[model samples]
Target: MRKITKGIAPVSFMEWVRQKPRNVDDNQWFQELYKQKRWDIVSDLSHHNAREQFYLCAYCCSEISGEGQETVNEHVEARALASHRSLDFTNIVASCKTKGQCDAHHKSQALPLTPLMDECETEFHFKISGRVEGKSARAIESIRVLNLGDNERNNKSLIEKRKQLSHNLMMANGLDPDEGLEDDELLLAVIDDLLTPTEGRLSPFAPVVANILRSWISG
Candidate 1:
């Protein structure tokens, strides 16, 4: 996962929250916000977070598309745990639809690593075979909790997709795995492109792709 720099909360949402009755209970206020069907606020938050995350899921790095349930405004600290921050802008992220896997299905389970934190990118290791393993206990917990590598629910799992993407990237760059060309400048350029982060778009499972590419060339 990549780090997302939380942007300012939408002014409209801020105003709405500020206008709420001061004595309202936090949980009640949260319920009210949902009951109001203030999807405009949710849309605003999703768009902003989608951009910040380069249009990828904050948890599994899947490409987020469409306005349907495939993409959702996921609360970083679940509303159940932090009802007080329900409307807090920084507490939300854009994640792929949770159809048994992904972020939305995980609920309030504690994460060992979060994209909000800088070091999260390095907390897991990706294998060329499409397997993902945590670098620490916390990272392991995060993987299981998020179902980052789960393949049971769907025919294609997160790791499987990542492996395909990596292979495609290699093929697109004309890098041959069967040959030993570690010092080739063209190969290095290909690896660099995979490693570099873009401003408004990130390749799915970019970190995993980059790491695998680096190992391929170095080996």
Candidate 2:
């Protein structure tokens, strides 16, 4: 997964925080805010995260629009585990509303590593086969916790999705993994093209495709 660089929090959300009741705990206050369906604050938070993440899920790097229906405000530290951080903007991210994968699968479980960490990007490798392998123990656990499709057997859907996207990206750019591109400078340019966001959003799985190509250059 890509490492997320969180920027400023929405003013609307902060205002809601200030209005929180003294008697209510952080967890309760957050629940009330969500339970109330305060679309203004919720939409602001979702759009902010979505824009920062390039419209991708913080956990799986899948596509997600900023719309409230498609993107959810996922607490990196689950409320059950870190109640004090319930209202902390730094602890929140945008995640896809897909079932049984990201947010839904996370539940109240602990995530040893998260996108917020730079090491998270290095700890996992996205293969052209569309499987992700952990380079560290914590990374492995994080993969399990997020159901990041460690293998085709466990999460075929995600694997297949990544595989197709990665392949399509390669073919669209005229890169052949078996033959390998010959021009070093041209290859670097292609990688740069893949990384550069268009209209403020990276194409889905663009980094995964870029990573696979990088292995060729570095090898």
Candidate 3:
């Protein structure tokens, strides 16, 4: 998992949330909030969250196209369990569709290890085979609950995708004619680009890519 830096909530959305009636029951409160045509504000928040994640699903690290039911405003804490935080921007994340056994569907109310935490990235190790191993129980549970590596009928498992990506990265870097030459400055530059975040959006599974690159370099 990559670290996600949550930014300040949009002013208008914050103001809207603040104005909601505090005395109402949770269900009523949510009903009113939705009835108020606040979907645009929700969309805005989702977009911002997506940008922070480089348009990738927070759990699976898959690219979210933000098109026709491809994305959802995922509540990290789960609205069923934390209705009070239903409208909380900090509790929200943009995830991919939950039609399959994806994170949103599998995670429900279970609190998985989040990218928002500082130690999130260090919890898991990505292998060149595309498998992810957790360094702790929390990470392991999160991976299982999110179905991060589970194979689906029609779709490639997340690990399979990561493995392919790892192979591709190696192939790209290995193609250099002066690969092990002392003055192979281009090699370092290429590796740096793969490991660092770009000015625009990052490639999907960026953390996985970085892991593969780092292992290759160490070897």
Output the number of the lDDT-best candidate. 2
lDDT tens readout by residue for model 1, 1-219:
777889787687777778778898655765676688877766766777787777888887778762546788777777778788776778878899957666655788766578888777777776766777788898887778878773434325665677788667666667654453566566667757865667767677766666555555654
Worst 10 residues of 2 by lDDT: 210-219
TM-score of each: 0.82, 0.93, 0.78
Who wins the TM-score comparison? 2
The lDDT ranking, best first, is: 2, 1, 3
Could you give candidate 3's per-residue lDDT for residues 122-164 as a string of tens digits?
7777765577777788888776777666333333566677777
Clashing residue pairs in candidate 3 are none
Model 3, global lDDT: 0.66
Candidate ordering by TM-score (highest first): 2, 1, 3
Across residues 7-125, which tens digit of lDDT does each residue of candidate 2 receive?
Answer: 77899999999999999999998888779979888899999999998888898777899898889999999999999999999999999988778888898999998989988767788
Model 1 spans with C-alpha error above 4 angstroms = 25-28, 150-156, 176-181, 184-192, 195-199, 214-219
lDDT of 2: 0.86
Q: How many backbone clashes does candidate 3 have?
A: 0
